[model samples]
Target: MASPNMQIARNARTRVADRVTSKVTDALKSDTAFESGSLALSARIAGAAAEAVLELPAEARRTLTRRQAELVRGVRRLVETFGDERGRRKIELIVPETVERSVGEGLGPIVPEEEGKHLLNELAVARKIEDWAGTVAGASELNRDYGIPRSTLHRWQHANEVIGLLKGTKKHVFPVEQFIDGRPALGISAVIGLAGSHRTAWLWLRQANPVLGGRRPIDLLKQDRIEEVIETAQAYFDPQ
Candidate 1:
């Protein structure tokens, strides 16, 4: 019943609508790929949808109506997920301002100013002990002063390299007798002797002390002072 030109126009409009709808459906489906272990798929789908919108015919583009807005949003989401270098630039643009706002707002808890000064004094004392020649005393003093558990101090003394570094000068000597008497103990040498290689010693050290950041015991042996190595070996053997 419609004129030929009218029929042609109707068909064109339907085709454009169908194409836009299909693209949106495809974008939605592709978005799920992010949850499916394919990180790149979502980006690709979003890029394609954006391109399709730009390439739409003039008449189709003009008739975009509400559909154009939806397509643009979809493209933006996709770009957010996986846009090229330019997209990353856009994302990072506001980060500095956001950080500034958070700082200005004082986002965290508000303690009394005097309480902060008192905490600093307590921290300085603990730090002084850690820097002294006697690590056990330093650890014990910190434990007592801060009400930190003895077990936690021991765990930190044995497991954390940063704690080790803080406990004494890098050049400080460790006496064999100290190890024998079970003063500063580690069992690296004994474990190595049992396991029959420096490699296994390293593996055990990493497993027992996750804070060492996967460093090998042998590597520690090479870097640490001979006395420190002996002390660490003794502690590992006799961690009581």
Candidate 2:
């Protein structure tokens, strides 16, 4: 077996080789990457220049000059805010989701307006729900802390007895409040069935309902007001 440092080096090389391969493929596929004199895509492209060929996220591809400028400004703000730490080789910078979206939307061909508006709307809604719901934990955390088995939790998720939100790219997180006495809170399945999705159910449950006199649906369920909660949810979905 290789030494740890040797293994690290090998992994680094593998990652670099993969990135180069991806860049080459992007060059071949991108119409904008064709050079005036160079017939070979591989000959003219490498590093940052080659990255220009990679396709942007669908919502980000239509960014105009103004959008690109927003990204530049965001990065500049980060650098200025951390100017004292600039001497360090690397430092992580955290920014709001809107600024993050600008970074992705800053590239690619300028298209018609409002291309990134949908992404912004989605980000805003996610932020609101996450803020209200709060303190989500993964399956392993719940198993370790609450003594609820992962298999049981997964089963509950499948049954819609529990609410699981896709916290990031792929990791699903359940709100701590979803579990009661090591089991899913009562009436969650009913709400999920009515709402049509776990996320929609959870968001609806957490939000203040006008029919329920500004009381959240989840609070009503906790108080054993299942019938009333279900009726309110029905009214919300129907609204006719």
Candidate 3:
């Protein structure tokens, strides 16, 4: 009953409505994808920044270079703006500064005075290594600090035994001698609680070892030899 022209006009209107709806749906999907991607990227960047900060000496953290502080602040801002508050809370639970300081202090005294000094010097070298490897330090630094040559350091770094040992524990374990104030006491549970990462804890244990000439904590753990952990804990918990 309608005229040909009216039918044509009605068809045109329907097409326009369909196109608008499709476009709106596509736009919403695109926006959601962009938001998710941005959050993920921010999280990765924040995590890396945190790791770098943790590796630095406590004194260095206090006196952070302008650039270093800026980077940390930037990451913090991104995390605050984009990260889910719940997720951020979880990260805080994992790696609190108090735990890091406790582990560092606990491990400090046990390091041979010479080796401890060498590790400090190595931090500068680590800066350069990061440029080449995307990390602040490498096995070479550890090797150099302990007077072990590069090849030996490389071998131990890749050894499965080392990796296993590093993963055996859930917390970072440092010797009492390493304690910042040379405190003679601390509990294993306390040490474990302080160390947020199993690997960091393992590294602390390995560093405290007098043997292996400074092999990584992972390698030591893989070997089923935790004499140092035992000895350190005993010394701390058992005062004559």
Highest TM-score against the true fold, candidate = 2
A best-first ranking of the candidates according to their TM-score comes to: 2, 3, 1
How high is each candidate's TM-score? 0.16, 0.47, 0.17
Report the Cα lDDT for residue 216, model 3: 41
RMSD of each: 23.3, 23.5, 23.4
Q: Give the 10-residue window scoring lowest on summed lDDT in candidate 2.
A: 41-50
Best by lDDT: 2
Against the unseen true structure, what C-alpha lDDT does each candidate score?
A: 0.46, 0.71, 0.42
Error of 1 at 176 (Å): 61
lDDT of 3 by residue, 135-188 (tens): 222344434444545555345334321221221245212221222221212232
Candidate 2 C-alpha lDDT tens digits along 1-240: 899999987676546645875666565655665664342434333433324424345555445222443344454565468557646787678866674333455567765558677656777733544586777889999999999898998898887889998876898999987666788779999888888888889889888876666788788788877776776677677657
User: Candidate 3 regions off by >4 Å?
Assistant: 1-200, 206-208, 211-217, 233-240
Let me know the TM-score candidate 2 reaches against the reference structure: 0.47
Question: In model 2, what lDDT does residue 190 have?
Answer: 89
